[model samples]
Target chain A: MQDSTATNARDAGRAAQRAAEARPVRIAIDAMGGDHGPEVVIPGAAMALQRHPQMRFVIYGDAAQVEPLLDGHPALKAASAFTHTDVSIKMDEKPSQALRLGRYKSSMWRAIQAVRDDEADACLSAGNTGALMAMSMFCLKTMPQVERPAIAAIWPTVRGESIVLDVGASIGADASHYVNLAVLGAAMARIVFDMERPGVGLLNVGREEIKGIEAVKEAGRTLREANLPNLDYRGFVEGDDIGKGTVDVVVTEGFTGNIALKTAEGTAKQIGEYLRSAMGRTWRAKLGYLLARPAFDALRAKMDPSRANGGVFLGLEGVVIKSHGGADVKGVAAAIDIAYDMAHYQLMRTIRDMLDETPIATAS
Target chain B: MQDSTATNARDAGRAAQRAAEARPVRIAIDAMGGDHGPEVVIPGAAMALQRHPQMRFVIYGDAAQVEPLLDGHPALKAASAFTHTDVSIKMDEKPSQALRLGRYKSSMWRAIQAVRDDEADACLSAGNTGALMAMSMFCLKTMPQVERPAIAAIWPTVRGESIVLDVGASIGADASHYVNLAVLGAAMARIVFDMERPGVGLLNVGREEIKGIEAVKEAGRTLREANLPNLDYRGFVEGDDIGKGTVDVVVTEGFTGNIALKTAEGTAKQIGEYLRSAMGRTWRAKLGYLLARPAFDALRAKMDPSRANGGVFLGLEGVVIKSHGGADVKGVAAAIDIAYDMAHYQLMRTIRDMLDETPIATAS
Candidate 1:
């Protein structure tokens, strides 16, 4: 497992495709995951296959339930190898219950195990995040310096895209944890944005006069002073800075990060609703909506959550991508796309090397 | 001091206007405050005076700087009484430093002091928020049960409006503090919504599988179990609920609350930018924009921050309204309008009575 740091994402993608002609990148997917289960997951893999022609999938689920769905998509059927599993983890099952009962027996566990066993480059699941996370951490242990695995989401910003991490993996972070998140997020930014060094910032309250949470401030102080190997630490950024793409990586403790992420999403949906309701007010406006519907559709497509579907479980020994349970085939494909790209670029190797090379100290 | 808790805001407004015919509502304005100094504040006061005909102002600042601006507006000059002060608090001044240097000397300090000294029914400032809070807390003092004062903002929701409190007055709230914020927000909602009982919810991370921050979860549990006076506790709400109008009062500690508030505002601005760029993309889209400009204008008006201008400092013995520092005449007028209504309806007395009557214990 060598570092993929020498090449950028585009160059890596070209190299991966060239390698793909020789030995295809294998991805294990939890087929019985998410709301639509095999219905979306099957077609989604086929859709992803079109994007990555030299990719293979290890599908884990009840064969009786999965085989017929695979039969519908001959392209996916050719690319996939199905594993028979009797048990499927429920979406609402507690992490403890899933660990106690399902363990390595369930489809979700087996998919993650494919990564741990080095049979597959990565695993993708559209299931309950907590269960997926627990199973991933248990099956694929975290890297040496990593204490807790974080969920990194791809955020759409004014400057295109940025990576935000620790979006509710585990709560309460120290300066070290914040620094760890920064390194991991920046690494992902390189893999995704094709940048060698990515700018990172710590999230804090925007009030000018008042001090932020002690831990966040401490993290900010440490980041500002420390000479992190690959990360370009830009000190403090506020909640608004996230959408503005003020930095490539916006790092925060799990709790605040989770709240801010969801708040921004909620605000977007709220404004969308306001726009729709306003457009339907009059006949003239309704006609305008029909005439300008293409632009609105383009806007909607840009704002689509499906386009940015995956949440990479960072800090784990193996790569795991979490897809939204409620996501459609398009969304599932998007998640798979991320999982493939991460694996293709060897994102895990890059982050591990960065963390080993430089430990972000709290003081200096 | 009397509690006007018997009637709703509509009836209260009608009665208040009639009472103003008998005795004018006297308000103290920090004329030297905000970005534009007395230029915006003077016209803002005059605009407010037009709405509340019998309202009188005690404008505090340098007489030379204040009187000329007021003189430009004949209506404001007739209703104003000037109190010259040598100092004006800087917009970026620290709360502690403002207290040390500007206390009872600056216009901001004197306005709040006027409220405390019974010279004015309410005090309004468009200066530094932290300094204003410190001065308000220092001069006005907290009510019987409140250990910390909260700044309550009127958030525009799908169902019209809701009150969200502790939007950065102070940070770190206990379970008891959450309950206090709920009670305070609910009381303010009653004044704004014209409803006797307002529903309150504690903001928590939306994830179903994972538990939220201990403080937030504890606050939610406390709010769920406890029965706050004149408040309907709806257990927990996610960040999305702030705009969904899911609850009349959203209770959160200052830190999370402040982040959420700014995040929403930033997202709104971001989306607005997206719309502008997309609409300008093509000639047809521009034509459609022209046709639907009125509807878009209505939506803009609805999303206007100026319309929801003041954040009231609740739990203080006296009413203190903090306006946005960079607000124009219309926005500042909105702040004064809120001050007039709060004073006319005796919001200070209502909160005091509510706190005294119900301490909002952490648990039942």
Candidate 2:
């Protein structure tokens, strides 16, 4: 018994040493962000650390508020584990104005700054989306040849998953901006979906070239002219195609993208509510529900928004991810994982390199 | 007993006559327009007629195809109950070009022409939406003082229901178009929801007046200046508000509105699939599904596109309802009913009077 105990201790120590030598990837999280703030953010960071011990986190917020949430987590206190930056960004303020006014002390601003200063590899926030985009653009700046930055969100589709660009970053953009969005989205799909050459589709009212407004027609022409290498430009796609996943990347202006994202969310919730009500109405249905419980749980797990928490603001100088404001701890953890994945993929460097080689012409 | 039976028959016939006299409104249906042609459209029209025997229908399509579908339906074939016009519109042609090229022979064009000739009160179609909008615009022209036409769709919500305007009519409209949509939508809500003063919200990326593209912001200002008496101008609303029923009427340009509507449909389908899968994975969930089946069915029935088949194109001089191309018999029935309602409310006349009172000032 004594010999076995000694062997176990030694093995544990060796495992610890190997983990320490792995050099944990640093992620900067806006702790004072989101509706729930540090209460949700800190625990999520701790949870992520528990799952990925090789990931180090820089929590940017009021240390006083965040430290209390880490009270009993010993692993979070390790030398190579956690760090905190005292700052935060308000959820209600105008994004551009907030970034300009609270440059130094705001948690969103500080998180982006950490990535720029090389203190952290990537930044994640669940704060004001506008403010985060503004800060990311001002601090890290856009990629060398990119016209404007775009936010890309993963839409849960029936076939699998698809990426929608410019969910709520730059509004009223021209055709050039849409072309940039397609390129950036393609880069994201390559990293996220492991596709060498991603299929790109321009979101329009209809599949026909003459169907949509002038902007969509112009964007289609620009995308064709750009002749992006790793992007297979599929002509045009309607709203239903977003879920069909026929195209890997769907590009549109921020206004349309934001509306599409929110509408999808609202419709999902409505349908779920409808199903619940339908199943509750009859005894025979109740029996069917019992027989189908496991499948239902599996479906719920697959569709859970918490599993798909992070949205990346692409075409910027650094890796910046935005989580939903209403996200819980599980969602925050998922966002952290996304930030890690982005860092592992070296997203910023890849975008910068791609932009350097291709000089995208701005629409006059 | 013989005398009583004769008296009862006479009383029933008298009651039917009273109902018919009370139902003064008539709706024109383009029966040969949809994918299913008269097979589905005739049955749907019959269903509507059965529900409201007083309602008269003017069927326009291929008489050979429509007549067989109504063979055994005595009431549908009654001379006082039905009128038929033989013509057809192909689905693939461009709406404007189709209207200009085929107006003399097309069933859809003739249906709208009938409304103009005062033979029918309103026109409904399950054919191409673009063609319907174009034909209505050309045949009816814009309301005396309106600048552009818009489309409005009633979307079901958790709380109740909300109206979204400019679904796909006026693709590249200016600020004035959005304001017109708001005014038109508010008028619709007053009739549909029976609200004396409907709350109108301008759809934007954010709730702030300063947010959104230049067109939206400019429209917001125009809406404010209009000071519509029966409109409670709610400043701004996001996409989530569509299903939340936060406001009675939501106004946006055609581009954003079309995307939002399609996204909602896609997401509802996705959520339904997710729930089905989840229910199949576990015994407990399967049982729960059985218990909840009736409630789920009810919810689905409410959210089903088939139940809400038709959308009204507003700001035109006459009523033009567009039904989903994939609509089945049941969907066709609902669309016919919607057409009846529009005519009953004198929706076109109401819009014309409103516009005439407040003549739209066209910007040079």
Candidate 3:
């Protein structure tokens, strides 16, 4: 009986080793990217490790700073490997300057390079968006059938969640680019939601067929006529439809997408402010708030922006997740969570396969 | 003593008559325009009359339908004059159809005609926007030095309200049109908020002067260099600034403006849903909600879309206020209130005078 138990333990060890060898997702993080830098990113990585035990991290920053922070948490220290880099990209530095001067030296550059070198499954950053995008485009390049990359955000909706694309990757997408966004965004929605056929819509001012601009109209025409296989092209969706979860994917040019995102964020914050002021009006209201504090706390957790933190850059050969520069420890963890999921699901491979199969005529 | 009292009464009557002759504000209403038609409009007019005793209304629709609704409200009956019109434009009618078929005979057309004929000071309608704009443009025409009219909405902000323009008036606007929107929006702000120098901003994706498109870039440059009077052109604002009340006027082309407006509305509704579900979670929460019902009611009123329902079409020869299609009595009242306010302050005349005095290089 003792020999049988020993044999069982040996079998378990072999199974664990085989599993690691089969496929292990590793996320490369820009440790010196955001406002708090290593102070926030290290703790965030530690917490993330608790949730995702299989996940491994390669943190890029000054070794002196990042190592000390990781030491405070043994789990993160055990799961992570530090890559020393003295140079860090400044938050205000222009994309051109960052690319020209700190190409291979900067933490942002090295983090992205890890993914390109096949050392990491995905790269996550809370750095300067423009500089990051420039570096990413330069290093990874565009995927097959893609002219430009787009930032896809998991937007919270009334129904559940929807993916919105081109939330400030580049501005002024023509008809072809709009159609491409639909294809790319649908690829994201499928992997994120585990859906076989996701519904995609072009973001417009109105749902009426005759309402939007020429580019949007042409994109709608193309989407309708082409009949893509992976996604159900649900012609046009308005701004309100986004929060209502009218479709699986909402696609638009960068300018409009960026404005819409910021607008929604502002509106949510505004309503929150209104709620706070309302509940604090009278003594009776205050007591009521205390009694219902648990419910409110639950709602707060549900509405927390950290849960919807990551913006994955699609149409790139490698996966890249961008977190808000001002995001705290929780937000950083949220972004890393996205990176882990994308890598585990082989999101980049799926996107490449889908693009190669997609029959877009204007994919130049 | 009796003779002196008689003399004082006579003098007061003459003074009142002179005041009425000087500038009496009159609003024209399309009684059969919205979902509930006269049922909501007459009651709303009555409510508005309670607030503005000096204002009068011209009701246009089937006299048989409108008269009875006004009959129950003696105040509205006393404050309004009815014009019979058997034809009413359908809510789904196209702009071309509205202009072609319902030109002179329809209630919507005649209501706008009132403003043109000087029978009413301004026009108010809770009808299809496309149809209303068509009929308005045909009847009143664009003002001199104006290329096209734009819809300006009074957006509720943390600091009172700000005017956001081109909210689905036209799809695309050039640099000249953006400059025109700023001037036109500022003019409305000056009259509505009683500010001599309203702060105007071009709504863009970012606060950075280099972030937006060519048109917006050129507009910013022109505004900064021109140093226009009656408005302090404060460069560019972001989507969130509209709700934050960073400026008195927010300018954008129709597409972005409409989407931003609708997105904010959707976000507001989304938060409200979250709030409702949260408060209904448990018996304790239910009891707390009951106790804090008054505070919630106040907050609801403060966030009420009805209070900010009116979308005033500016740069037209006359004022035309558009209300939401599914508006209730309170919402209808809000539109009428805007009409009354615009007429009382002679908003159109002020806009024209401002245009004449302004030195815009592209006033063609």
Candidate 4:
């Protein structure tokens, strides 16, 4: 009986080790990229480690700026997997110009380099988006069948969540870029949500086939013609459909996507203020708020900015996540988790495999 | 004493008639437009009459569809200014195609004709925006000084409110269109906010000079060169600034503006849901809600959709206010009030004067 128990324990230990090795993932974080910089990023990193002990992190930025914030956290300090880069990409700097001028010194560039060099599995930043995209493209290069790298963010919706691509990656996009966005967004939905066949919708002024600008019309034709497998072409979707989660992925040019993102953020803030005031109006309303408080709390948690912090820069040779510059500790932690997930899933490898099987057409 | 009283009453009556004659303003409404068609429009028209008895209205669309809704409203029926066109524009129809096919038969066309023939001072529609814009331009024609008419909407901001132009007017806009939007948006701010010098911000990705697309760059240069009087060309503004309301007017292409507008609406809905959930989380939170009810109610009123329903389509030959398709009675009332105010202020005449004085220089 003793011999049988010992054999079972040994088998369980071996299985655990194998599982850990199979899912080995490391995330490189830009520790000095956000508005609050090291203060927010360090605590976020520590919290992420507590939540996901198996996940490894490389802290990139000024060591002097980051170390003091770490205090005596042994996992952050003594972990052989962690390291630092001594530079940062400023939020106000012109992305292209900064990339050209500060290529060697910028933390953003180094982080991408780490991912490219296989020093880290994925790179994450809360820095200038343009700088990050430019650096990532320059360092890691685009994936095998991709044209432009798109910044994709997953937005929570009524039905579920949908990924919006080219959020601010390529501005003034042509038909081909949008097609690539659709492809990348589909790939992301597959990995993120385990959605085998994701619905792709072209963002437009109206849902009708004939509505929208010339670019949208041309893009729609290209998307339909591509006939990508595991990509259900759902046609056009308007602004309202985004929150309604009518489609799994929404594709558009960076310019439109950026404006859409900002507008959503602004509107959310306004609505939150309004609702708080509404709940405070009368005794009966106040009582109703008490009765419905649990449901409301659950809904608020779903919509919290911290819960949706990280956005992936897709179509690159390596995985890269960008967090909002104004992210708090919780937001940073969320971004780290997203990066860990992308790395563990081997998102880039999956993208490469998919592209390898698919033939590349000339600009769609 | 009786004779003296009679003389005074007669004098007052004549004074009132003279006041009315001095400010004769007429407005044309597409009575057959919107989901409920004449049902909402007729009541809105009656409400307008109650608010602004001095003005005149020309109701365009099938008389049968509109007249039934106005039954028993003697004041509305007695208004000889009301004229009907026996046609309608369908919401689902393609704007460009419909405009061409139903050029003479559509109510939108007839409303534009009223403005062209000087039968109405301005025209309003809660119908298909593209159809309205196409018909308006076709019949009334672009004002000689204006390049392309843009649509402008008032978006609520933290500081107050800001005007966003080219909501969906010119889809494939160049630098010149953006410059025109800036001028139109600035002019709107001056009239609407009674500002002698309104600040205009070119909506872009970042505040830096080289951050935006080529069109935005060129528009920024053009705006700087024009140096219009009472215009504070404040260069570029990021997305967050839209809600901050640091600038009185924000100019962008219709594609970007539409996305921004829709995003704001979606975000607001999301935030409202979040806040409601948060308030319902705990017993203490519910108790606090009761105490803070009045203040919350005030905020809700300020952010209510009814108060922010209408957005004026600027640069057209006449006034046209677009209401939300999902607008309720209160929203419709708000839109009518906006139309009434525009007519009373002679907004179109002010725009015409401004355009007449400005040179037709290419916007960089």
Give the runs in model 3 whose Cα sits over 4 Å from its true position.
A1-21, B1-21
lDDT of 2 by residue, B244-268 (tens): 8889999888888988888888777
Model 1 clashing-pair count: 1
- lDDT for residue B128 in candidate 4, whole number 0-100: 77
Candidate that beats the other on DockQ, 1 or 4, i.e. the better one:
1
- lDDT values of the candidates? 0.83, 0.76, 0.85, 0.74
Model 1, B1-364: lDDT tens digits are 1234323433443454455446778999999889999989999999999999899999899888888887799988888888899999999888899999999799999999988777788999999998999988888777656768899999988778889888887777777788788878888888888887789888876634147767667766666665665778887778888888899999888887887788788788888888988888988888888888889999999899999999998988778999999899999999999998898887865665465446344221
Off by over 4 Å in 2: A1-23, A79-87, A225-227, A280-291, A356-364, B1-23, B79-87, B281-291, B356-364
List interface RMSDs for the candidates, in order.
1.1, 2.7, 0.9, 4.3
Q: Is candidate 1 or candidate 2 better by TM-score?
A: 1
Query: Can you list the residue pairs that collide in candidate 1?
Result: B9-B194
> How well does candidate 3 score on lDDT at residue B317?
75
TM-score of 4: 0.88
Clashes of each: 1, 46, 0, 12
Better of 1 and 3 by lDDT: 3
lDDT tens readout by residue for model 3, B220-246 = 998888887788999899888888999
Model 2 CA lDDT for position A5: 35
Q: Tens-digit lDDT track for model 3 on A1-364?
A: 1233334433443453344357678899999998888888888888888889888888899998988898899888888888899799999888899998779988999999998887788999899899999999999877646778999999999899999989999788889899888888888888899998899999897777888899999999988988878889998998999999999999998888888898898888787788799899998898888888898898888778898999999988688999888888899999999998888776765675566556675454
Residue-wise lDDT of candidate 4 within B154-259, one digit each (tens)?
Answer: 8888778888887777786778777778878877887878887799998887777877789899988877887777678999987777887879999988878887
Task: Report the CAPRI category for model 3.
Answer: medium
| lDDT, ranked from best to worst | 3, 1, 2, 4
Residue B185 alpha-carbon offset, candidate 1, angstroms:
1.2
* Candidate 4 residue runs with Cα over 4 Å from true position: A1-23, A68-71, A82-86, A100-102, A275-300, A357-364, B1-21, B273-300, B359-364
Task: State the interface C-alpha RMSD of candidate 3.
Answer: 0.9
